[model samples]
Target: MRWSETCLSEQLGIDPGKELQQLYLRILRQDPALTLDPPVLATEPAAVKHNLPAQVTSFNGRDWEMIEVREMITEHRLVTLVGGGGVGKSRLAVEVAQNVLDDFPDGVWLVELPPLVQPGITAQSLAKALSLGEHPIVPLEEVIEDRLKRKKRS
Candidate 1:
């Protein structure tokens, strides 16, 4: 069935421009299975750490009990700074992310999926927010991997 459609489209002499449209179609059909070689990730080293925002106030000993948590975040590759409401966890994450934004040359991106009420659609909301319109048909993991790789590069 697909072969016939391709043949028909070919025989019709309907050329949607041999350059741009063909390239666009190639983009639409890009897949590892279709092509022997796939695109490679950027090999640039990580960016240097940048200075944090001056607006961030330092944590007082008694004020932020999450000092250990903050230290863990600073030390670990990935830290989940979790806490109760109004417990300064978000504030801490913002500060930490700001402090290390330069280290992540891609930049500190805060994806606020507040309007995304459904957990199932969180990825879609994030993709839209990030302006990553490609690969909508692919799984969320693939989208995230692609975005993270691109972010790491630039």
Candidate 2:
């Protein structure tokens, strides 16, 4: 198969255009006056599992850092990027996550930590990002851990 086709089909395991088309059709049906509901996405493990937002800008040239981060993520279960503000950390992270989605069958999840989030709510924020809504009976840390553990490492 062609390289571009292989990336979309094998790595992402998605009909690249179908997802976007679905969103467009759903948006077209929404009533213009009413506030749109929060994303009602598929919850099944069988579904294409990614919550990555569309990239607004292009990633230009950072080949070395990309290679390093990708290798680290593959070797370690978790990798953190530290840098000053405006250092393109988020973009680089997102780009690397996109590249490595295939290595993770369950999904590659991105949890955002904005300054607005209160210090105490870090775990809750991650749970929300993963779309595991308030589970009153169970601790969120456990819930997040359970979800992450599902995909057996390659």
Candidate 3:
């Protein structure tokens, strides 16, 4: 079955522009077997070390919040830390991701999105972070998803 961007955006409850919709459509066209549900692979021992940065100073207080964040990470696949600039949201996210590194056998990756100027570049940014080269025919998101699926099966 073919899918359009408007249909997908309405189903996902997000308003994507014409360009994003075209990209999504292209991704769907390139990979006919893609689905909303990610494929599950057998669990295996982690082969790579996490890429978290070394702590420069001691983390003081926030023990309660830390515990809660850790629990949330364990329970949820996606977690967002919202706060103003310099409020340590990024630091907390890193700490939480680092703490749960063992939970993800494929290793936790930090895709810094600060340098991204447009929302359309997200797939490209993720692809670059994962060291996957771009393909002429396939969308970046498809390549990234394929790589992630391969990682799960490895």
Cα lDDT tens digits, model 3, 17-131, are: 7777676677868765554677677797646655678788767778888999888866654455776778987787777777777677777776655644778677766777688
> Candidate 2 on 29-136: residue-level lDDT in tens?
874754667887677457756778789888999999999999998887657687888998889989999988888877787776666457647677777867887677
For residue 90, model 3's alpha carbon misses the true position, in angstroms, by 1.6
Candidate 1 Cα outliers beyond 4 Å, as residue runs: 1-58, 61-80, 113-117
Whole-model Cα lDDT per candidate?
0.57, 0.76, 0.71
**Number of the candidate with higher lDDT, 1 or 2:** 2
Model 3 regions more than 4 Å off: 1-47, 63-72, 75-82, 149-154
TM-score each candidate.
0.44, 0.58, 0.54
**TM-score, structure 1 vs. true:** 0.44
Error of 2 at 137 (Å): 5.0
* Model 2 CA deviation exceeding 4 Å by range: 1-46
Ranking by TM-score: 2, 3, 1
Highest TM-score: which candidate? 2
